[model samples]
Target: MDQAVCCYRHPDRETGIRCTRCDKPICPECMVNASVGFHCRDCVNQRGGTHVQPRTIAGGSVTSDPFLITKILIGLNVLVFVLELALGDRIVDDFGLYAKCVDLQTLQPARCGVSDGEWYRVLTSAFIHERPSPVHIGFNMLSLWWIGAPLEQRLGRSRYIALYFVSALGASAAVLVIAPGALTIGASGAIFGLFGATAVYMRRMRYDMRPVIALLVLNIIFSFTWANVSWQGHLGGLLTGTVLAIGMLYAPRERRNLVQWGTCAAVLLVTLAVSAIAVSQVTS
Candidate 1:
């Protein structure tokens, strides 16, 4: 008079609960709570047995928290700025980018940079800003919030962060080549990188390009005209970001991740190679 059914996913487990959509029995492990009743993971994913995950424009996972990385980045910059104030200018002395290891007493290059293993400065210095002025950190954080959040949403966290550091390294490479002896610091390079990427994205999405263009032009002028600005870093980052964005956004969908990450890796290698040559050129 009565019949028994076993879970479809796990044959050994006996369950009375059936998925309302599929009417197939499911064990608790395979069950996802639904509004009406429990649903099999398959039913919930809505792709039959295999779940189809949502993907971002650049092939990263669609995430609930799109701006998480951007927020963390801004928090970090602000935290580091606070550290700069508390720790004094010594923080800058130790971390700021200059191609070579510099003797603190005379502030002259003591050895070949990056090649000799003090390579961390290339990326680290992007986080270090002038201690006295709030203007520098304020403007940069605002730019990061406004520009970075949207780009992060489009590219997703992994690609966005990769683009960021690559841009930083590109900026660092230019500093090493053009002004090796000078201590360069700030997020301007990375910000310019975001600006470049944003422009590419707008063009890709068929959005009006005039606003971003005008902003970029204004910033470029400011970098050159403003005293103590690192125009070299800005230009380097812009070029690198634009190139990287093209590779990411225009990659063939079938092999998107491979081509996208491969492009990032290639750009990174080229920047490092340039930095290596620059170290020798600047030191020699």
Candidate 2:
């Protein structure tokens, strides 16, 4: 009588099955179903194995709906605009970005501004726009869809959201430094950040730069030329986004996530520091 072949894993247990990939005798417990045949744990856990999940360019998870985050952002901006219109100027007064502002009508004390401990205005102000100008929100939303959608798709949701938030805060900080006490509203700054990032990403991929360059130039000119526009916000957001995109896109593959997210944290901290200093200048 011939002796039975023992499983490589369980030497005591006799088995007829073998790992299709490595051709080693395996027990039933060690078998993993594959398209062609069974695979062992070692084969499945290898670098090019089925267990490995796909990753985005910036080390984000490859999502089924790449544009979901961009859509959500647009929805939030629209919702805030509607609330501003329905609830009156109180929304603007409370959320609008300013180093120092007062109730122009009442003239008693400005309920809004960074000086009075309303630091949240740094980010909230990006969502509110001029109530009388329907064009304000309209232009911003269109630009957002154009620039934000593709950027969000490439960078993925978490990285994209971080960029938007930090850019908005950076815009408020610049407003504090450049035009302190000036009331700034609209999503122009955040949208400008998207423009800057898109331009950088195009350059990284060696795409034609003429279109984004032209658009950025035209917008920059308009920001300075147009009355009631916050040029300071635009400038700040552009600088921040450009720097962040470089960090996210060029990170080393081995430590990509750590480097990319760390860059975001560093930029955010610097913006907060600048904002704090600006606030101190006003208060002191």
Candidate 3:
């Protein structure tokens, strides 16, 4: 069967897999699978010859696409943060962007129609914060890059990304429970999950996690003292990440990939649900 290879750039073109760089249709002669994906000769040259595949991709089964997913995620987080800052006070004036955090008894933000809802806040709150401070974004981006790259390489792309979203939700759940109407934002929750994962990995390998643990603890403690930091978000991410790492590392290796993935996913969802419910109870 002569299967048509689709052009990477042109969705309409029917051809074999084209070069990533030059957009040329490459037959077996010209196509070379790079570290990330298949590329044509011209494309390869543009990238400075052969692509440098990471140790994880060369040896690990995790998809390359997911491994690079963190970059996009981090970028999105930053963009949203920027928008929140630019909008500033006008957020209430122009856009309806309002804090969902509300007092259980009175619901201040909700009274002004500012607080959207608990569920919507669960997702949107992570992207909104007080001013787009470099410190806020910098800490988050740094944490994600440090934790996400290695974890993505180790766990593969899908699981790594799944962990990120799940942990963020979990962090949100935590914030919702502790502070019903407390305005929150940033990727600290997800970063905490990464910290959790690192802690678990270090423990599993019987390596000294003292340094990482100390760093995590110190950060967490500081979050309590630091008026601006979302301590609940940090705690939520850390707990979710720890649980997920345990599931990822301890589950039977012989189990199907789907089962293993599901296990980790289930943990994250369950954790989020529990946190949300707990928060509702506490606040109520």
Evaluate all candidate structures by whole-model CA lDDT and list the values in order.
Answer: 0.84, 0.81, 0.63
Candidate 1 lDDT over 1-284, as tens digits, reads 33556889999865566788989987545656454555676687675555445455566765789899999989888899999999998778778897766677997667644646779989989998887889999999999999999899878789999999999999999888888878899998988899999999877655567899999999999989999999999999999999999999888766778999999999999999999899888656
Q: TM-score for every candidate vs. truth?
A: 0.80, 0.80, 0.67
lDDT of 1: 0.84
Strongest candidate by TM-score = 2
Q: Which whole-number lDDT from 0 to 100 does residue 225 have in model 3?
A: 99
Q: Which pairs of residues have clashing backbones in candidate 2? A: 102-110
TM-score-based ranking: 2, 1, 3
Evaluation by TM-score, superior candidate among 1 and 2: 2
Cα distance off (Å), candidate 3, residue 150: 1.5
Output the TM-score of candidate 3. 0.67
Residues 1-284 of candidate 3 have per-residue lDDT tens digits of 43555444454544434555666764323446554444665665676765534222112343536447788878887777677677675442323222343445874534432233335545555554455457777877887888787777666666677778788777876776675455566677887888898787666545456799789889988989998777888898788878877777665435535565776668766866675566545445
Candidate maximizing lDDT: 1
For lDDT, candidate 1 versus 3, the one ahead is 1
The ten-residue window of minimal lDDT in model 1 covers 47-56
Worst 10 residues of 3 by lDDT: 53-62
Please report how far candidate 2 places residue 256 from its true position, in Å. Answer: 0.8
